[model samples]
Target: MNGVSKVSPGVGTGLSKPVAAALSIVDCDFHPFVPLQEVIARMPARARRSVQVSSYAAVLGREHNRFLIPTGEPLRLDAVPTRGGLAGSDPAFAVADYLDRWGIAAAVMMPIQAMGVIAWAAEEVVNSYLAAMNDLFLEMWHAEDPRFKMLISVSPHDPDAAVREIERLADKPGVVGFQIPMGEIGLGSSAMFKVYAAAAHFGLPLVLHPNSVDCSLQNSPSCAGRVTRSYAEHHVLLSQPGQGAATQLVMSGALERFPTMRVVLAEFGFSWVGPMMWRMDTAWQRGGGADGLLPRPPSEYLLNQLRFTTQPYDEPGNPRDLVPILDSMQAHRTLVFSSDYPHWDTDRPDVVLRRLPVELRERVAKQTAMETFGTRLGL
Candidate 1:
């Protein structure tokens, strides 16, 4: 495979030509992922086989025959082109191409496959695979560009290993923080304390990404559900588990325990902020909840420790409404812009900005992301 070169602008490389040559933007959510097989290959031999067996079992156990066949595939391993095959299917989705085309200064890349799914396997298997995947991402993608940073994926099923992994990778260049799925292993469970503690100690954020666990829903009988239903369930489940976890962390004294830990609710959307904050505040003001459980209202803890990413935004809603909503939620500094690139429903800054006033656009696009990630525009 040929070494991939950064696609330069104005060379007609199939990217949308930038409207402003001087515009500097940083995309908080971009995904430039490696193949699963590549991640598998990087593991130790025993760990590699274990992952394969688990993956095979999961696929074969499924009722669908889709797992058995060798679907037609390609062997090329370079960054899949921004133009033909699976790569070019969406003209606007290429990360490198989009960065250059849109005049983005940098982007923080997240993994495509949710690492939490691997936690369904045995603990050792999941931990080893998670470590391998993180190491591979650090060595392969993030190392290639100083501007491209990554969120290290962690499996909370084994909190000890999760802590060790965080300690090992905390200082590694290009690793900005850790990514945890919303409903994986119940955030309120005692099992996750060590992981949260480790993140706090390292001064790295724990990003709660949106995903569905088999046992997350309260009364859902079987994990088997239609794909569309599951997708919808995943989105709705996001804030519920996150809120539950945040509440637990406060009530259980995780925040009192750590004091400096930060959490980011990525891609859970921002509409719920208003109501969630109101309810928490109301409960606290009335002294309706346990007094010794937390130092203040749950919303107060979240304001200090939590942040959220905005994507799949509702453009039809009044933009001015977001300002006060965030302020009331104490999330003004917590809201960051995200593109959710490569997904079907992604936000286009150029088009989204045209709808908003110039001041709002600058805050959401650049200032918010910079504050959240603790980095400045490379440009």
Candidate 2:
């Protein structure tokens, strides 16, 4: 709010010439940040006071992204606003820097800190901070630019509060879906059923964001049962939690209970999905309908309810080798393009387009995202 300019008309105005051909692309995983002080200022006095005493770093979790990169944060140096503000802190600048640059039709704003707070902060603090952050983005970003979409940030710790938050903002313009932080709590746990039900009622899907904190935190159970020692280690195994979440959703019969519910595993690699599906289907058949919970083979549930983002795209010795795996997973229907914008490892839309086979490019880039989100994206 301090240094960011108010958004104006004519997105892509910053570019010397418009790249009209790329305008149909939808970026499913773009990160936007609000200054912590701004979120603090919007909070109730009680929550403001409580958060003041808590260690901000501990409350937000130790962000390895900042230290892992040379720029003191995971952001690309070029993504920082030319007007002098942190990367992703300014919505108007992000429009010019990312959305405009790539001709992205809409870029979903995935606020990592907001998602992290849901996992790390006190219940009251988490609720209060999330409410304030939601309002901040609604007014500061969404209201200003419709091209910048958002996900409702909710905590799995308090299902009632999470439901209330979902109901409060589900109708807001540019709010596409719900994002829950990944931690010890598995997505398919009974405690999460209420949140899942609420999302389905509103036609909003749930998004799971895997993080380094979930893998290393002492109290939170790691998917691997051991803490990661380095950024690379954490990054490599990042998809494990996503795999676990997807497994739970299918095996626990969450999708069966809520037929309309959908889940998006964002920023988690898609390569593992093909093998995981095979393992799940085999286990489901051998275990007699997953102990009477699942009604069909696990892959059936996954194919109908789960979707994945393609970023940090899997590259092998031969790029052509990826075709069969992509086909096995029905990637054209399940995979969506994500730029992971502003991060050091961000992918360019054109680059991702080239990596994908010509037949799958259109759907992966835009169609799947539109189908996954439907009218919620206001596409």
Candidate 3:
């Protein structure tokens, strides 16, 4: 599956032939980036050395911030071919290779390193690094193929800078949206509101992703005695952003203020959304909420405004039971399929789709993503 193949042109394993043929599947989440040394080489002089030092320290397990340490052996720059080296990592595996292999038409490439830069760097440093990284991505990846597009990275730590960057890149050929973390700087804060306004103004979806926020858990109670908590953090981090950010968006009336704004809670599994929505709704009814605290049911706000990605999905004993849980929680259209490509927990599309029931599989695999990205099939 190294290159394109022409299959029968329908969703192969799920749904009736007619319905499958009608669906135009687009993988809404993908990632693409150069090797770390190459990225460091491109950074400004002021930050380049520090960034490189951090990278080395990370690989050696010498960095104080556990989040900064590499989870595996660092990629040797010498091992990556100088002329063409796109196939080794997860982004290439998902966006480029998987599309050709799985019969997907296109994939929106999100940022991985940008999330780290935003999470750890100072506001000014993060903004500058983000601009450079976005340009690097546009030139290196997005411009290479129309089938691959991008979600521009933004540092919400500096709302004004983020707004300017959004305006600057909004109309660029392959840029589709903005990327921000799920729980950074408090989702309800005024700074984030500005970022949301900019996205709404440009008709771009805000992709709320997970990064170091989960990495912080290494020092928490659950992992205190353990030498490493990366795996646990990775799984649990998915729900935290959705839980905390959704509460902020509803309670602070950010959704009320920006009716047209859309949010994609990336990497976070959809299983928790139903329960969170129910809990918020129940609390609202009991006068322990944000509406009278602000003016609507938190779930209503979510139903109208939010979309979530399904990856690292729940394995509640019986795999067949997942779809019904999603439906019971009213999370059908709200769920979009994501591979979390290149990471340890990457789910195979074929496997995940096979696990889902027919109708539910169709919605998660294709329909919901099309509706969320506002792109038509065969476009």
Candidate 4:
């Protein structure tokens, strides 16, 4: 971060590399939440009173205290701007603190907390809240910065409306992809297939962020069978739903149908990815898909159609242990760096991956993300 030859990428002050030369990143999981007031103001006149902008995940499991997870404010309190805005809600502060400071070439903006409202809000009101939040992000953040890219937040509860929103934003600058909850609905259902079709038509990927509830969801994801008691417990298992989503999407022919679409699993660790792929490939080959639901092995779809972010890198103690797992998962091309910034457990990019050899470092830090995001990042 200091004493290095760093040039400005021409967004904020200048472009610079993240903590170390090897760690210059294309940050894939930067969370920018909309301020509550802005969110409410954008709501339709009739429904604004009933629609709450707070997180609906608070009520998901009556058994566990979800409150303890986020600990402080969801965003880092210190990052809040002096100009009076929420921590992640301010574009200027984000640029000064995150993008320029880290020398990140590009950052994908996933404004996800707003969608957390959909789980408990009135069913009919879900689409409006999402649409308004999408508008708010476009106006407040996307228009304010060149380095920020957009991930349109939409729920699959109303597939037609979701498609309409996707089409509307598809042509807009920086509208790179969609962010949907993995467990909100079954990934391979026909309802979700329509949404995927819209994304494929637009040539945008879907970023599967972790969240397990939705007002209109019908089927339970194979993962998340019960609520856990601690933040650490919940954090450790975030990959379960991600795994379930990948499994459902592959087994049910969603990938087969939407061949051009891509998926990025955000903040979901990679330790389980290798094992999951092996199990699915094994089952698909031996159990038989005579009906042609799965025309090829599950690994083919998983490898070709999906990309994953590397943050909260599963290994905490010994960095050497990660080498074999990364090899098994073919992480050389699949992994991208993410700094779940401004959170208590946020991984410091300089410290986390620098221990790896330079070749692997280049893949995780830059090449894989450039390949996954493509022209959307102007790569």
Best by lDDT: 2
Listed per candidate, the RMSD to the true structure in angstroms reads 6.8, 5.5, 6.3, 5.2
Model 4 clash count equals 4
Better of 1 and 2 by TM-score: 2
For each candidate, give its TM-score against the true structure: 0.77, 0.89, 0.80, 0.86
> Candidate 4 has which clashing residue pairs, if any?
8-14, 8-15, 9-15, 16-103
Candidate 2 lDDT by residue in tens digits, 126-147: 7989888888878888877898
List the candidate 2 regions with Cα displacement exceeding 4 Å.
1-20, 52-59, 62-71, 118-121, 216-225
Ten contiguous residues minimizing lDDT sum, candidate 3: 217-226
Q: What TM-score does prediction 3 earn?
A: 0.80
Clashing pairs in 2: none
Off by over 4 Å in 4: 1-24, 53-67, 121-124, 214-225, 289-292
lDDT of the candidates, in the order given: 0.60, 0.78, 0.64, 0.71
Report the C-alpha displacement of residue 213, candidate 1, in angstroms.
2.6
The true-versus-predicted C-alpha distance at residue 259 of model 3, in Å, is 1.3
Against the true structure, candidate 1 reaches a TM-score of 0.77
Candidate 4 per-residue lDDT, tens place, 34-96, comes to: 765666677787767776433333222221224254464455555666575566767888887
lDDT of 1 by residue, 139-210 (tens): 766666656677877765667877888888988877777886444466656688788778877777777654
Q: Which stretches of candidate 3 lie over 4 Å from their true place?
A: 1-24, 35-44, 47-52, 56-96, 119-121, 182-184, 216-230, 288-290, 376-378
lDDT of 3 by residue, 52-124 (tens): 3344332111234454224453233222322345322433333324565555655677766665653344566
- Among all windows of 10 consecutive residues in model 4, the one with the lowest summed lDDT is 214-223
Cα lDDT for residue 324, model 3? 63
